[model samples]
Target: MACMKLGSKSDAFQRQGQAWFCATGLPSDIIVEVGDMSFHLHKFPLLSRSGVMERLIAEASEEGDEKSCINLPDIPGGPKTFEFVAKFCYGVKLELTASNVVYLRCAAEHLEMTEEHGEGNLISQTETFLNQVVLRNWKDSLRALQTCDDILTYADELQITKRCIESLAMKASTDPNLFGWPITEHGGPMQSPGGSVLWNGISTGARPKNSSIDWWYEDVSTLSFPLYKRLIAVMESRGIRQEVISGSLTSYARKYLPVLNRHQVVNDSSSRLEPVGLGAMVSEEEQRFLLEDIDRLLPMQKGLVPTKFLFGLLRTAMILRASSSCISNLERRIGMQLDQATVEDLLMPNFSYSMETLYNVDCVQRILEHFLAMDQITGGASPCSVDDGQLIGSPSLTPITMVAKLIDGYLAEVAPDVNLKLPKFQALAASVPDYSRPLDDGLYRAIDIYLKSHPWLGESEREQLCRLMDCQKLSLEACTHAAQNERLPLRVVVQVLFFEQLQLRTSIAGCFLVSDNLDGSRQLRSGVAGSSEGGWTTAVRENQVLKVGMDHMRMRVCELEKECLTMRQEIEKLGRVKGSSAWENVSKKLGLKMKSQMCSAQEGSVSKQKNGNGKNRHGKHKKTFTPDPEA
Candidate 1:
C-alpha cells in the first residue's frame, strides 16, 4: 500500500469568512477548503465522522492561536469524489455508479473511514458497491478500473490494485485463449527497451509493445504479487500453459517504471486509459531491493506471506525471475520444508515448477544440493517405499521420479539448448542407478558423456551401464552410443551389440514384451525419455553391425537372452511344483526375504524385459586414475 502521509493538522482563529458554512442552515463554525470548493459545515460533524480530523481539531484547539477554517487543498479524493463523500456524510442517498465507486472506496480508506460503520460511511458503502455491483459484472468492473487509471497514485494508496486485478483475473481464467496469441507466436524472445534481451538464459524482463491494446498484459503487470499469484493459479487451472504465464509476467519486473499518459481505450463501446507498457526490467539495484523484501519473509510466509504491518521489522528479499538472491531465499525455504516433512512433499508439481524457474535461472545446483542433503538425512528410502517393479503409484518413487524427471529434462532440454550448455552429467549420472533410468535419448547422451569422462570407473558401473543398454531400452542412437564407447567391458559390449537380433527372436516366445500403449511412443520406456529412441540411429546401426562386425555380438546377445528366459521359466515352474529339481537353483537366484526385509514391487511396469535386465542391482563403480593428456 502507498500513501501521502497526509501531513499534520493546525488551527488558527484568523476566521476565514463563513460564505459556504452559513448555507448549511446550522451554526457555522469551520469552513473547509478542498480543491476549489468550500464546505461550510459544523466542526462537530467533521469531528464525529473522521478520527483523523477529530485529532487534528483537538490539537488545534489546544494551540490557542488558530485559523477558524481548515484548508485541505489537494486531498486524495478530487472535488467530484469529495462532493459525494460530503453528501454521504450529510445522510443523503446518491446512486452509486462504477465511475465513482473505486474513487470513493479509495477516499474512504484514506480518511480512515471505518468499514464496520455500514453504509453511512463512504468506505462501507463502497465495499457494497464493488461486491454487489462492480465486481460481479465484468463490464462494470472494467469501467471501474478504467476510472482508476488517472487516479492510480490515490487508488494505490488504498490498495485498490489487488481488488481490480482479482476481477480481471476471473475474466482471464474464464477464457485464456481470448488473449489472441497463436501457439506459434509464444516463446518468442522477450524483448526489453532499446532491443535489449531479457530472460537471458534464466532471468525474464518485459513484454514487447504493439499497436493493439493488450489489456490482459497491462492489468497483469499492475497487480501486486498476491493477486498475481492467484491469477497464475487460476490461469493454470484453466489449462493455460505455464510458458504463457511466465512470458506475460515478465512485465511484472518493470511495473515501477513511469509511462506515458496517452489515452488508451479498453473496449470499442466503453472507456480509456493511460498509455500502457512495462519496460523489460528495473535496474539491478531495484531488483535487489524488491527481491530482498520477499526473501526476508518468515519460513512459513516465504510463499505464504500474510499482511500484518508490524512484520516490517523483517528484511526484504528481492522477488523477481532475474533476482538471484530472491531465488536463494526460496531455495532455503524449500530446504527447511523438507527437513520437517513427513512424506515426499517435494515431489509436488507446483514445487517442481517453482524450481524450474530456478533451473532456467541456472540456480539448480543449490536445489540439487538441498535434495541430496535431505536424502542423506532421511537415509535413502522415504517412509512410503515402493515395493519392486510390480507396483505403481508409490509416493516413495515421487522423489525418485522427480529427480529422474529433472535429470531427464536436463539431459533432453537444457544440456543441448544453445543458451544452457550445462556439462555436469557425471555427478547427475552417479546420483541414480541404471535400472531406474527413464527412457530418453538424452539418457544415452548423458551416460555416454559420463562414461567418456570417467573411463576408469570399474566393472560394476560398466555392467550397470550395460543393463541400461538393454536391447529394448536401446534406440538405434543408444546402440550407436554403445558401439562408439571404447570403455565398455568386454561382456557388456557383447550384450548391447547383440540386443536387436535377440529382441526379434525373443518376442516370438512369450518372454519379450513391449506394452501396446507404450509401443507407440517410448517403444522402450518412460514417456519423456523414450520419445526420441532409435529411429534414425537405430536403423543405421542395424545396417553397420550386419555388414561388418556384429556376428559375435549377435551370437552373444542371443545366447544371453535365451539363458535368462529359460532360467526364469524354470524358476516359475519350481515355485508352482514344490520339490522340483530346479527349486534350489531358482531360490538362490531369487534371494529369499529375511525377517526384517520387506517385499518390493515396482509398478508403472514398462514392458517385461526379455533379458535379465529386470533384475534390481545397485553399486558404485570402482575407478583407477587415468592421466588426461590435457591435465
Candidate 2:
C-alpha cells in the first residue's frame, strides 16, 4: 500500500504492513486490501485536515479521475473505508500503492477506463456507429446529391442524414461540374423547390437556364450557412451579377447586425464605420444624400461629385439651388452665402479665371505704365526704356545714318499710305520745312532719279539699287561719275583698275592694249600709210596689229603661268619645311649635342651681361670677341 498525501502542504508517507497514509493533512486514512492484506488508516484532526480534503476533492473533480484508498495506522479510529469509496465515486480515484505512486499515471489510467466504460463512452460509441452506418448506406446517396438543397431534402426524407452534410457542403462548394449543373438548368441531384427560379423577377425553370441555383437563391435571404456557402459557389460558377450578390450580402449583414453586435462587433473603439460594397442596393434619395455627405467630407468639395450618376444629379441640384423661388428666404440667404463662397473659390489664386480675360493693347499699356510708375517711384529703370543708354547704347544720330538703318526697318514694316503716330522728335522734325531732309531730300531724290531714268527696272531692282547706294554712302560726285561713265563701260574700267591695283600679271597685256593712244599723231601717220596699201593691205595691217596684241597677250599669259607654277612650288617647299619633325635631327647634325644647350646658352648670356654690368660700374669695359664674319 502507498500513502497518498492530498493536501495544500505536501508530506511523504511510507507503507507499513498493508497500509500507509499521508502524515500532513487528511481527514482520514483509507483502508486498503492489496492481495490478501487488510489494514486500517490513520485519521488526522478534522479542523486541520478539512482544507486539504476539500482541495484534493476539488482537484480530483476537475481532472475527472477516479479516487482510490491508501490506509495508514496513526489515526484516532483507524481509517474510514466508506468515505474513500464515496470520494472515488464523486472525484478522481488516485492510487497510492507503491506500484503506482505518481498521480498522472493514475489519472491517465482512469481516463482510459472512463472512455472505455464510463458515461462518456456512450457518446463516442454512438458517433462511431453513426459514422459506420453513414459510410455503409449513404455513400452513394451523398455522392448523388451535388448541392445543399438535395442534401437537405434527403436528410429530411430520412434517406440520408446530417453525418455527411459537412462533406457534401465542401463538395458542392468546390466541385465545378456538380455545382455547374444546378446553375445551368441541367438535370442534377439538386433542384430549387420552386419549379421556376427567379432572377431579377424573371422566372424560367426549376433551375436558371442561363445562371445558377445559387445566383437565384442569393436574393432569398433565408439560406443556412452551408446553403449560403453552396449558393455562393453557384453564383460564382454562373457569373452572377456582383451587384446582386453584394446587395444580398449587405442585406444579410443588416439582418444579422444585432446578433453580431452581441459578439462585441461594436466594442472596438478604433473601428469608426462599416464599409459597404459598391454593388450594394440603395434608393435614389438615399444615394443622393450619401453623395452629398461624401462631398462634404472630402477635402476638395467644390468641383467633386461623389459618383458619375451624382454628377448630373448634383448639377440639377445646383441649378435648382440657384433659381428655385420655392425655397424660403432664409434658405435663399444661405444659398447666397454658399454661392459667394463658390464664387470666391472660383476667384481664388489657385483657381482664378481672371487670366482667361483677354488682354488688349490698352491693358498691356496700362500694365507697362504701372511698372513704369513703380520703377520711377523706386528710382529704378522704366520697363520700356527705348532710350536707356545701358539698354540700347546711343545710336548714330546722322540723318543719313538714321535713314539708312532705322527708317528702313520702320518703313519696311510700316505702310507709307497709312498714318503712324510718330515719336515726338520725329513729329517735331516732320513739322519743320525740311523735316525729312536726309530721307526725303537726298535718299528719296536719288531713288526717284534712278527709277525715273531706269523706267524698265522693276520695283525690287530699284529698291536694291537704292539700298546699295545707301549702304555705300555714295556722294553725288560718285553717282554722277557712275552715270556719266556708264557709256565708257565703267565695269571694264573697274576690272582693269582692280587688276592694275593688284599688279596681277594676267591683266597687264589687256590693260596696255586698251590704254593705247590710237588718236595720237604717230597713230595717224601709221593709219594713213596703212590705208595707201589698199583695202586688203589696210585689213592686213589691222590684222597685224591685232596679231601683235594677241602675241603680247599670249606672252603675258605664259609669264603668269610660269609665275603661278613657281609660287606653287615655293609654297609646297615651305609647307614641307614647316611641317617637318626634324628639329632634333638638325640640331644633332649641327653638333649641338647637349640636350639643354639652348637653355645653358641663355643662362650664360645672362650671367655675362650681369658680369659686364658689374665691371662697367667699376671701370670702362671693352668687348674682346669680334662679330662672326659669316653672319
Candidate 3:
C-alpha cells in the first residue's frame, strides 16, 4: 500500500524510508519537519496576522525533526484541515506534535494572565509574595513616616514622649533604628559628669557671662542637671543658642518630670521628696509669673498630655483641690440665689405667667356657664333639696353633684309617667305605686352608702355619677316591657329588678337602702322623701309603705294571671304595641298611618299556608293574596 495517509486532505509522497506528506490546507508560514520529511502548511490569513501561525512555526522548528510526515492539528479554520493532514502523515509519533505544544503554551499563557481565566493558583502565589515583602520591610516603612517634618514638629511642640516619637516613626519605616541614635553615647546615659568636659566644669572662656551661655547653664541646672549637661554640650558644639537650649530643657522637664517622679517613687522611697512649695520659696511677683505660666500650660495640657499624667504628680494637689472646692462652693451659692430668686420672682405678678393660669380662667368660666345652663334646663329649680334649717344646705353643688340631681329628677319625673301606662303594673296599682318614688329614694340611698363606704369618693364619685346621667335618657319601651313581662309590681319591682340591675352593672355603687328589717316590713324609707319639719322622716315612711303596697298588689295580679292564663294572654296581646289597640293609639299619637293586623306567630304561619294553597276555608281556590308592601 502506498504510505497510509494520516489526514484525509494530505497528499501522499515518499522520501528515504519515511513518508513525506504535505497538508492540503495549512498556514503557509507553519513549516513542519520531522526527520528530513517536510510538510509545508498554511494557516488562515487571520491566524497568520494574529500571530497564531508564527507561534506554530516557532514550535515546529524547535523540535528539529525533518524526516517523518508532519501532522497538522486543528487550526482556527476547522477540524477538516487537521484530519486531512493527520491522514497523510506517517513515521511520526502521532501525539508528540508541534501543534499540541503550541496549543498548550497558548492555553497556559491565556489561563495564567487574563482575569477571565480563573487561575486561583497563580493569584495565590502573587499575593503571598507581596505580603512577604511588606512584612519584611515594615521597619523601612516606619522610618519613612518619621521623615515627615510635620509629624516631627508636632511631637516636639507637644513635648511628646520618646516612646511616642519612636512609635510614630515606626509607622513609616521598616528599620526604625536607622533614624534612632544610640541612647548610651552621643549625649546619652553612658556619658557622666566627671569625665564629660561639658558637665565637669562651667564654661569660663571669653563668652559674655550674662549672654546666651549663662542662660543655657541656668536652664540646664534648674531642670535636669545630668541630662541638661549632656544636652548643653551637644548644643554648644552644634552652635545652638542659650535660649533654644533653655526652651528645649523646659519642654523636656514639663513633659517627662511626672513620669520620672512616679518611676523614682516606686524604685526608691527615700528619693521621693516633696515637691518644692511655690508659696514658701517664690515671692509674690514670682508667684504671679508662675500662675501666668500655669494658665498658658493648661491649654497645652488640654489636648496633648493625658490627664493621668497630671494626676500622677503629687505636686498638682493644691491646684486640683482648689479647683474642685471652688466649683462646689460656687454651685452652693448659685443654688441659694436660685431659690430666693424664684420666690421673689413669683411674688412679682409680671414675672409669673403660665399655661395653668389660662386653664384655670377658662375652667372657672366654663363652670359658671354650665351651672347657668343646668338651672335653665331644670326650669329654674332650687339647688337646695329641702327648706329645713337644721339640715345642711345644697348651695350650688359641684358639676358632679348637679348632674346627679339632674339624673334623679329626670328618672323620677319620667318613671311615674311611663309606669302608669304599663299594663302589667298599672292594672295592679291605682297610681303605679309611684315607681319613681322608690327609684329616686333607692338611688339617693345608694349614693349615700357609696360615700360612706369609700370616703375617698368625695367629689369624684359625684362627678362620675353626673357624667353617667348626662345625655342619658330612659328607654321607655324597655321599661314598659320590663314592668309588664317581669311580673314585678310598680313599687318593689322597680327597686328589686331595675335598680338592682343597675347596681350589679356598676360594682362601684353601694347598697341601695339601709333597712335594718330584712322582712322589708319597717316601712321602706325614701332618701329624699320628708318635707320641712319631721325632716323628710314622714315622707320617707310613706314612700316605703307605698312601695310595699305596690309590690303586694303586683303579687296579687300575678296570682290572678296564673289562675287565668287566657285572661292574662288576652290582656297582654291587647296591650302589645306591635299589633294591639295600644299600638294604634301610639301610632295615632305619633302621627303614623296604621295597617293593623292580629299579631300571632301561628296565625301568621297559617295565613302563609293558606295563601300558598290558593284556597280559603270555603274549599274554593281563592285568588292569591299579596299583602301591600307598604303595610
Candidate 4:
C-alpha cells in the first residue's frame, strides 16, 4: 500500500484508441509501440530520457529517415508498464507503489532509463523506492515480490525478488513482537504494522499467549507455490523452527491442494478439479505434483507434524495417484508417530483400482510394521515384559500400547467389509506385538466383527483368526461373550469356557481368602463401642454376597458340564461320520480331556464349599482337590 509520487505535474496524456498522445499541442515525432499499445509523443523527451530510444532515433536518422517507429514486443511488463515509463519520460504525473514498483523497475531497466540517460531518472528513482520503502515494510515487500512472477527473469536479474524474499524471511525468522509488525491468522491480519507497540512505548499485547507461533503462515500462504517454496528454503536456512515451517507448508497445501480440504478425490469418471478459488481449479496433474513437492518439503523430524495431517496426506496421495516414493515416505513418517493416531485417521479408504477391500488394509499393515520396527529400535516399551505381570489398561502404558488400541479399533471398523480377506485381516491384527496388547478384549471384538461379516470363512480360517487373541488375556465379559458366540470355532469356544472356569475358580479362592481375614477385621472393629452388632451385620452381608457368587459359579460349572457332554456327542458323531483313524483319535482326545477337566473343576468347587463349611465348624484347614494341570 506504500506509494511514491515521482512527478508533481498534472495529467498531460490522453488516449485515442490504442494510441496514447501527448496533449501539449505538439506534433508527434516518435511512435513507440509496446505490445498492442502505441505512444505518440515528441522525440526530444523520449530521446533525452531513454538510451534505447535515443539509439533507435539516431539509427533512423542515419538511414535517411527523420521519424522512427519503434516496436517493443518483448518488454518485461508489456504495454501497461511501458505506459508508466513513457509518462515518466514526458514528466507527466506518475506514482510508484509496491504493486507497480517492481514492474516499473524492470521496464526502466529494459529501456536503459538510468541516471546516465538523465539525472535522477526512472531506474534510480525506482531503485531508491525499492531499497528504502518496499524492502522496509513487510506487506509492501510481499506485494512487490508477487509482481515479479510476470517478469521473473528480469526480477531475478535485478535481484528484486531475492531481496523481497530475504526481507520477508528475516522478519519471519525473528519474533514479530520484536519488530511490532502485523501478524496474520486465518487469512486476516491481526494488527496494523507498529500496532503491537503503542506510541507511548507500552506494548498493546504481546501476541496473545494462546495464538499460534506460526501466525505468519496465512500471510505467506497467499504466495504462488514456486515463490512460497523459495521463501521456505530461505527461512529454513535462517534457522526457523521446523514446526513453524511445517505449519506454513500445511497452510500452503490447504490453499492449493483442493483434495486435502474436501477429503475426496477425482475418480475415473470425472477428471475435473474442485474450485480452489473463484472460477479457478488446479489441474489434477498440478495437484499431484504439488502433493509430492509438499511431502518432500516436510521436515524429517517426527512429532512436529500431527499424525492426523499425515494420514490426510496419504489419503490425498492415493487420490492424486502420487509417486510410490511419496506415498511410502508418508507411511514411514506416520508409523513413527503412530501412537498419536486415532482410529479415524487409520481408516483410509481404498482408492486403487487393483485393491478390493473397502479400506486400505495393506497400507495400514505396512505402517504398523514400520511402527513396530521403530518401536523396537527406540526401545519404546517399558522394562516390564508381557510376562512380567503387566496388564492392559495400565496407567503407564507405552506408545505401542496406544497404537495397539488404535489398530484394534481400526480393525473393528474395517471388519464389516466383506472384501477384506481372512489373510489380510489376520496379518494386520497379528502385526501388533503380544507385549503391546496385555489384554485381548479389543482384538477379540475386532475378530468377532470379522467373523460376523465373514461367515463364509472356513472353520480353519476362523480358528486361525481367533489365534490372534489369547483366551487368558480376555476379560470375563469377553470370555462370556465368546462362550455363547455361535460364530466362534468349536475349539475356541472350549478354550473360552476353560479359561472362564479357571477365572471363576480364582475368584472363589480370593473370596475364601477374604473370609479368612474377616474374623480379624471384625475383632479389630470390636474396640469401637456399639459397633459389634454393625460388624456382625457387615460380615453377614458379605457372606451372603459370597454365597451368591459361589452359587453362580456352581451353576456355571453345571452349564460347562452340559456343554462338555454336548461337545462329546458332537465329536462322537464326527468320528462315526468320518471313520478315519486320525479323526477318531483326535475326537477321543478332545472328549476325554474336556469331560475329565469339567468333572474335576466341578468337584473342586464342591470340595471348596465343603471345606469352608467344615472350617467354620472345626476351625481347621482341610486339603482341597486341585484340578490336573494338563486337563
TM-score per candidate, chains pooled: 0.35, 0.15, 0.14, 0.82
lDDT of each: 0.46, 0.32, 0.29, 0.75
Candidate 1 residue-wise lDDT, 1-631, digit = tens: 0011111222211224433343455566665777777776666756666666677677767777345566666556576676666556555446676667787787777666774433356667677767765665444554566566657777767656556656666665554355442222223555422121234442221222233334466545544444455556656666654445544543443343212111423223222233322223347565455445434422332223222211111112222233555556556555433323322222222123345322232334455566566655665433342332222544454565456545554544333323322234345445544434434444666555545655666877666664443344665456555544556654444344345334433442322132222233433444455535546466345434332322332343344445444434544565477665565655444333210011111110111222222211122222212222121
Which one wins by lDDT: 1 or 4? 4
| Candidate 4 lDDT by residue in tens digits, 1-631 | 5577887677888898998988887788778888788898778888899888889888876887666787888888888888888788878788898889998989889889988889999999999999987787666777777788888899999999899999989867766665554444422344434223222443343232224577567667667778888999999999998988998898778766776667544232232222212223368888888889999999877888888888988998999899999999999999999989998898888998877988988999999998888877876655444642365454445788889899999999999999888888888888887777878899999999988998888988887788898998887678767766778876787777667666655666565566667655655666655476765777676566556555555555556556556665565566357657867676566656565555656565665565352111112222223332322
Count clashing residue pairs per candidate.
36, 12, 48, 0
RMSD to true structure for each model, in Å: 20.2, 39.3, 40.8, 6.4
For residue 605, what is the lDDT in candidate 1?
13
For the record, the alpha-carbon RMSD of candidate 1 to the native fold, in angstroms, is: 20.2
lDDT of 2 by residue, 1-631 (tens): 1123222322244446655443434444444443344433332221122333334345544665444343223221123332332223333333222112112222222223234234433223323333432222212213212222422442334332343344333332343454342353423334322333434444322233443324322233334434444445455455544544544443443333332133444434242222212223234443443333323322222212222222222332333332232212212222222212221121111112333322111222222233234333544332221221122322322322332232223222221212222231132222222221232324333334434444565544543444322222333344334333322222222322222222323233333334344324335776677645465465445545544544443344444344334333433444356434553343233222121222332343343333221000111112122212111
